[model samples]
Target: MKCKILPPKGLYHPVLPYKQLTSDNTHKLLFGLCRTCMNKISFKCKHIDDPTLNKHDKIHEIKRCKECKNIKNEKCIHSDEERVIVGTWSTIEIDKAIEKGYELQKIYELEHFEKTSTDIFKLYVDTFMKYKQEASGCKCDPKYCKNDCKNDKECKTKIQYIIDNTAYDLDIDKVKYNSGLRFIAKICLNNLWGHFGMRDNFTQKNIVLLLEHITKIVFNEKYKDISTMILDENIVLTEYKEKEEYSKPNPSVNVYIALFTTAHARLKLYELLDILQERVLYMDTDSCIYNDDGSEACKK
Candidate 1:
């Protein structure tokens, strides 16, 4: 939430109490996606039912959802990749989408930049750390835990405990964004915390909590009995669970990257599956990263 450019104090993406599109001036239909980047694709004006918008006073059937699959604040079942294969998106690619999405501020003019290798690296690193705490979740004292610890099998209630509770709360080394470190972090976080982005039903805090619980489960030595557990790799993932996957975007237009990645990853997952000896390999997240063999463990 601390944008490198703005670095505004106490800056968190505040949520609208109601799902009204017209609530924010930037929330209007056909408006650029500077505010809800991922939401652009999945939250198209033709689709979606944000009570906040209240545009349609007389409509029976819902139109398609335009918010990008990757946006955390928007709502959509399919990620970017799924939406592309279905051909529900516009012809715009990441670069165009970004360009088209930008709305110059009254205070500052807009500036365009190429999608150079450097920018890609920056995005990946930003994307990685952005979801790390969410993957790692929080730590907690058994007595003060408030996240329904008694109910949750994994009772991790503290997150970045050192970052927030240490005597030097204001003193910290900023985590730098690098591809090497980011990818590793993503693998770990995605498997544990799932992904967060501009989409409905997502928040920086929630993702962090999930990740904390994951680490707690591992360190607590609970999953040691995976042999008899009903776990999906790690978390009790719902079918629609995902991390970094491109979800359908809202009308915000910032989901261009998600749309691009989803389209590529989805195609690769399918094309690579046919070449594999086991169809199951296609289901693994790493198939896109490696195609050496179809072995189960190797698949991961």
Candidate 2:
């Protein structure tokens, strides 16, 4: 399965030697989902205790499964007889999971993954990079800049160097010796990515001083999830998430973009992990700590 778009959701039966499978961290029936697709699916597995049933006939039977859902790295079903809803995964992860002994059984697709040739953020990213280059002159040579040059062309070269390296930008290093450019850059990018995935039904808060206000809030069908806290005899704090139709969606919010961004990030991390393997000590969303044997393991 060579998927150029976002990953898919499926049920896979466990095979032998499950050490290499990307085990679901949530350990739930319905795990990671692409909110854009809402690919929530269900399956029915048969469990029989007949002694005449062979291992193959054990069809969907999982006996004394050591690792139920959510148990990390532990073998779940005793044999290939059971099929578990092992969360949504990218095709790369699916390939690795198969290599580690998992068989795909079923998949439910509510909507197809989105793909396009047009770069959505081309203008924004290009503008940001150009602005960063122009704002910082050659004199502000960041640590990432290996060569010390005195011309504007060399300054452009420095920007190119920053772009090629893993370090996001010189502003990241500027926090200590220069200004709070890192935070400024981070918030801008964070908000940019977040804007595309903002939920319409955010928890809203209201300060109530009148009895009618409390009544209006409590009886409002628009506010599906409602809660109130009284700070004073006349003052109350009411917090609730509005129903979908009643809530206003952000005009810029496009779940497809958000899903693509996240899916690509996971694949990148997975690629790094595939290289590190046993050497990986700890890993986060975009970073990792691994045991290096002085062989420049990352370069591999």
RMSD of each: 23.9, 11.9
Task: Give the clashing pairs for model 2.
Answer: 27-70
Candidate 1: regions farther than 4 A off: 1-86, 89-119, 122-184, 187-197, 200-253, 277-282, 287-300
How many collisions between residues are there in candidate 1? 72
lDDT for each residue of candidate 1 in 92-136, tens digit (9 for 90 to 100): 222222242321112223224465332544555555555443333
For model 1, what is the error of residue 190's alpha carbon versus the real structure, in angstroms, after optimal superposition? 5.3
Worst 10 residues of 1 by lDDT: 1-10
Q: Looking at candidate 2, what is the lDDT of residue 57?
A: 53
lDDT of each: 0.36, 0.54
Over the stretch 251-276, how does candidate 2's per-residue lDDT look in tens digits?
Answer: 88988677667767766776777677
> For model 1, how big is the CA root-mean-square deviation?
23.9
